[model samples]
Target: MSPSSCAVLCAAVLSPCAIAQTSSSPSVPAQVAGQLPTIEIRANQDEARADLEAEQALTPGGVSLVDGESLRQRSVVTVGDMLRYVPGLWTASGSTGDSSFISSRGSNLDATNYDGNGIKYLQDGLPVSAADGNNHNRQPNPLAASHAVVARGANALTYGASTLGGAIDFTTPTARDGAPNELLLQLGSHGQRQGSVTLGKVVGSFDGLVSAETRRFEGYRLHQKQERSSLYANGGWQLGDAVHTRFFATTIDNQQQLPGPLTRQQWLDDPRQAEAAAVAGNYRYNVDTWRLANKTVWDIDADSKLTFGLSYENQQFYHPIVYAPPFFSLLIDTEQRTLGSTVRYQRRMGSHDLLVGMNLARTTVDGGNFSYVPGGAQTLSTSVANRASSLELFVMDRWQFAPNWTAVYGAQGVSTRREVRDSNLKGDFNSINPRAGLIHQLSPSNQLFANVSRVYEAPTFYELQDQTPGAPPNTLLEAMRGTVFEVGTRGKQELGSRNRWNWDVAVYHTRLRDEILSRDNPTAPGTSLSINADRTVHAGIEALVGASFALGGSSAHRIEPMVNLTLNHFRFRGDSTYGNNVLPAAPKVAVKGEVLYRHADTGFFFGPTFDLVSSRYADFSNTYRVDSYALWGLRAGWTGKDWDVFAEARNLANKNHVSQFSVRDVASANAAILSPGEPRSLYVGARLKF
Candidate 1:
C-alpha cells in the first residue's frame, strides 16, 4: 500500500480510539469469502480523532472539507467544480448550474445581506434553494456527494442559521453508511456521457438506498445541449436505542439547449456561431423532493447526550423562457415548502464542552409569471405569494481554558416573520447574535486562532415580494448587516522521514450595514430601484497547504501535494453606485494546485490540477470587466476488488471566459449577456461494488 505508505498506515490507524467508541460499537460480521477488508482499529482511530477535532474546532471560522476521496481525486463535476479549492468562493457561470456568489473575507456582493453573507445551503442538514435567490444553482455532483462542508465568516455563528456569507453542508450517501452495489459508465470530450446506478439493502431492521443517474452533454458552444436525469431513495430504521427513523426521496429531470448569450461582436464574430442571432432558449426542469425525519438520542447517563429533531420539506419549480426584446416569452412557476424543528443538548463536562440549541423554521412560497410578445399574445400574467418564519435560540461553549487554552462562546436569539400575500406586506424581525472564540495549542502540532461575530439579514421571497412592473411593491429598503473579525493559524508536520504536512492560515475583517443598492429611478425615468446604502468595507486572506509522501518500499506507493490561496479586498462606504467598486462577483485573486499519485498494489491513480481566477467587476456600475483565467485538470484511476475506473480532463485551457454580467443600460453603456461559459471538456467513467 504505497501512497506515502498508505498515509502512514492511515495515520497510525486512526489516532484517537475512544469517544465512547462511538455509541458502543458492536455489530461486526461481514467477513465473507475472499476476506481482506478488516481494519477498524477503534474505527481508524476514532476517525482520525474526529478529523482532528473537526479541524481544531473549526479554526475560528472559514471551514472546508471535501471528502469522498477528494471528490474522486478532483474529477469534481459542477458546484463550481467543487468550489475550486474554496477560499472566499465566487464560482461563476449561470443561467443554469455552477453559480455561486459567495463572499467571505471581503464581502460586498451587494454588501452581503440576507444573513451577512454568512451563507447557508445544506442537503443532509436539509435546506437547499439558491437557484433563484441568485446563487445560481450550485450543484456540485460527485455523484451527489458523500461529503462537503464549508462554513465561512464569523465562523458561521455556530450554525443556528443566519448567514453573513458562509455555510454549505452536503452529505448524501447512505445505507447504514456502507453504500455498495453500484455501476457507472462514462465517455468524454464535448460529446460527454455518463450513467450510474446504486442499490443497497439490509432488509431486516430496515435500511435501504437506491440511486440512479444519467447525463449527457455536447457543448463547447454551437447548438449547446445538456441533459440530466436523477432518481434517489433512502430509508432507515433503528428506533429502539434512543430512536431513529428516516425517509427521503428525490427526482430531477432536465433538458437544456440554450446557446444564448454572446456579443463581443458575437464573440469576435462567429466563434462557431450556430443561429448566433443570439437569444434562443429552451429548458425543462422538474424536481420532486420529499423528506421526513425523526431522530432522538437521550442517554444522559454516560457523559450526557440529548438530541431531538423533526423535519419536512417539499420543493418544485418549472420554467419556460425566450429572452429578447422587452423580455419575451417567459413563463415561470415555483413552489417551496419547509417545516423544521431541532433541539439539542450535549455535555462532556470535564474540561468543559457544552452545546444547547433550539431551532424552528417554516417557509412557503408561491410563484407566477407569464409574458409573451414576440409578435403575439399574453402580455403579462402575474401572481405571487410569500411566507417565512424563523425562531432560534442557541448556546455554545467549549472551554478547556488550560492545557493549551481553548474557549468558544456563542449566543443567538433570533426571530423573523414575513408575509406578502399578494403585496399586502407584513414584516417583523428581532435579533441578537454574538460569538467569541479563542484557541491556542501552539504545540502538539501547533495552532492559534481568534474570532468575533455579529450578523443579520432578511429579505428574500424575491427580495420582498417582487412585483416587476416598475419594481417596488412590498419594500423595506434594506436591513442587512454584519460585523466580523478573525485571525488564524494552523499546522501539522513530520516532513523529513518521508513527508506529511498540513497548513492553514486566515485573516478577515468586515463591516457593513443596510447595504443593498440598485438604482436608476430618480422618480421613475424608466424605473428600477432597491435602496439602503450607507456603508461597506471588506478584507481577506486565506491559505492552505498540504503534502504527503512515500514511494519506494511500499505502503502502496504514494504522493500528494496541494496549495490553495486567495486574497481579496473591497470598498464602497458612502454615496454608492459602485464608486469604490470591486465587488461584482469579486475575485481579486485565487489559486489552486494539486498533484496526486497513488498505487496501492496496482490500484493505480493519477491526478493533476491547477485553477486560477482573477480579474473582476462584471457590472453593477463597475463598468464591466471580466478577464483573467487559467484551468487545467486531469484525473485517472483504476482499482479492482470491487472494481472502479475513471478518467477526466476539463477546461484544459480553452478559456474564453465571462460567466455572468448585467447592465442592460440605465441609459446605455452596454452589458447584456448572460451565461457564456464552457469550452473544454472530457470524461470517462466506471465503477462497481457489491
Candidate 2:
C-alpha cells in the first residue's frame, strides 16, 4: 500500500478511540477523578523503563521483548533456547557450543555455519558487535540480561542500526532489577553441570551488582565438549537527583571442541559420531575476553536528557582446524582490541519529540597462522595486521499530528573503512539511508503501524580474508543494499469473562541488490568463496498469538496457549545462473506452539510444546531437498517465594534430523553437509534467592 493510504486507514480506525478517551466517563469514582493526573506523573518515576517504553512506542514495525524471569524458569543455555517463541527468526543450533546459524527475514540465507554479521548486537544500549559487523553467539549471555529487545528490519533506526536483520539489545541486570543474593545449580543429561551466583546491594547513594556463572558439558555428539566461565558486574553512583553515572565490566573464558558435520550416509548410520577428519585433527576453539565501559546521564530538565558512554574490549583467540588437507592441521591465533563510544540527546517539546545520536567504533587485530604436521615442528605460514572503523550519525523526530496519531521521520549516515596492511587490501563504504513511519493508537492496548526504509551492509573481515595458501584476499566484493516496506499490528485485550489475549502480526517485502552467496570448496569443510548476486527478493509474514483463560471457574487456575509462525518466500530474482529459483537452506514455513496449565496461587506450571519445520532446497540449482521434521517437548516447574525448581525434556522421540548444513550452488552426494540434531535429553535445575 502507498504511504498516504496506509496513514488514512490507520487514522480511520484510531480516530474514534481518541474521541472516546477525551470524553469523561461517569463510571470513574469521584474521589479518584482529581488524582488521575497525579498517578500519571508518578507512573514514570522508573526512568529506565519509561524511556524504553517511549522508544518502543515510536517504532512502526516488528518488535519483540523477552523477559529474563521467564527464561530463568527454564533452560537458557543457548540463543536458540532463549528465543524459542520469537517469530521471524530461524536458529540452527551447533550444539557443541553457543554458536548457531541465525537468520531473520532471509537476511543471512546463505550463512551455512557461524556467520552472524547480518544482525547488530548490543549490550545495555552499547555496541557489542565488532566494527565490521561480525558477531558471535557467546557474547550476549542470557543469564546476565534482565530483558532483551528485538527490532526486526528497519525498526532499529532509534539505535542507529541500518541492516536487513535489524538489532537485538540485551539489557543487563542492575542494582534496581537484580535480587539481593541468589544461587543456582543445574544438572542434565550428557554429563552437563552448571552453577551461578549473584550479589546485589545498595548503600547510601551507591548501588552495585555482580554475577558469575560456570558451566561444563559433555555434548550429545562424540568429541563435542565445552567449558565456560563468565563474570558481569556493574556499579552506579547518584551524584544528584538528576545526575547518575554507571560503570560496567565483564570477563569471559570459553573453550569448545568442534565435532563438525557428517555426510548423509554417516548421519543415517550413526548420528552421534563426529566427523572423522575433525576428530583426527582435534579441532578446537578457545577465547578470552575482557571489557570495561562507563555511562553517564544528565537530565537537563524533566522534558530533556543527555546520555553518553565509552567502552574498551580486549580479546585473545585460538582456533585449530584441518580444512582441505585432512592430514595437516592449522593453528590460528589473533589478538584484538576495540574502542567504541556513543552520544545521544533527547528532548520533548509540546507534541513533538526529537532524538539525535552518534556512534563511533574502531578495532585493530594482530593475526597469524601456523601449520602443524604430525610428530613434526610447527611451521609459520602467513601473518597479517588489520584495522576497521565505523561511524554513524542519526536524527529522528516524532510529531503527534493528532491525539492518537504519530508520524516519524529519520535517517542514518554511515561510513566504514577496512584495511589489511600485510595483504595490501583497503576499501571504503558509505551510505545515507532514510526511513519514514506512522503509528496509530487504536486504544490503550492496541496499535497499528507501517514503515519504509533502506539498509546497507559491508562484508566483514572473516568473509574477505583468504584462508587458503597463495590465494589473494576478496578485495572486489561490494556492499549489499536493499529497500524494505513493512506493516504490523499488535495489541492486548481482556475479553470474555476475564480472558486475556495478546497478538503481534507483521508482513514485509524487501528488494535487494548485491546479495552475498558463498561457494564451498569440494574437499574443505570450512573454506568458502564469497560472490555477490545481482538481485534478490525476500518477503514474509510473521505472527505470534497468545491467550489465557481461567479453568473450572477458578481465577487462580488458568490455561495459556501460544502460537508462533513464520512464512518466507525468498528467491534469486532473474539471475543468469540461478534464474528465479528458491534460495538454498531456507525453510518456507516454521511453526511452534505450546499449551500449559498454571496455578497462579501455587506458582506451578507444566506445558507441552511442538515444533514443525518444512523442508527446502539444499542448493541454488534446486536439485537436492532436505526432508521436513517435527519434534515434541515437555517442561514443568514450581516457583516459590524464595526458591524455584524446574525440569525439562527435549526431543522426546529421539528423532533423527538435520539441524543445519553448509549451502552450495550444486552439491554431490558425498558433500558431507549434514549437522545432526541432538538426541533426547533431560535436565533439572533449582535456584535460591534471598
Kindly give the number of clashing pairs for every candidate. 25, 0
Prediction 2 TM-score vs. true = 0.91
What lDDT score belongs to each candidate, Candidate 1 first? 0.59, 0.77
lDDT per residue as tens, model 1, 148-238: 7777765754456645666676766766766666777777776767777888787666787878888787666665666777777777776
Provide the TM-score for each candidate, comma-separated: 0.32, 0.91
Give the clash count for model 1.
25
- The deviation in Å at residue 21 for candidate 1 is 42
Best by TM-score: 2
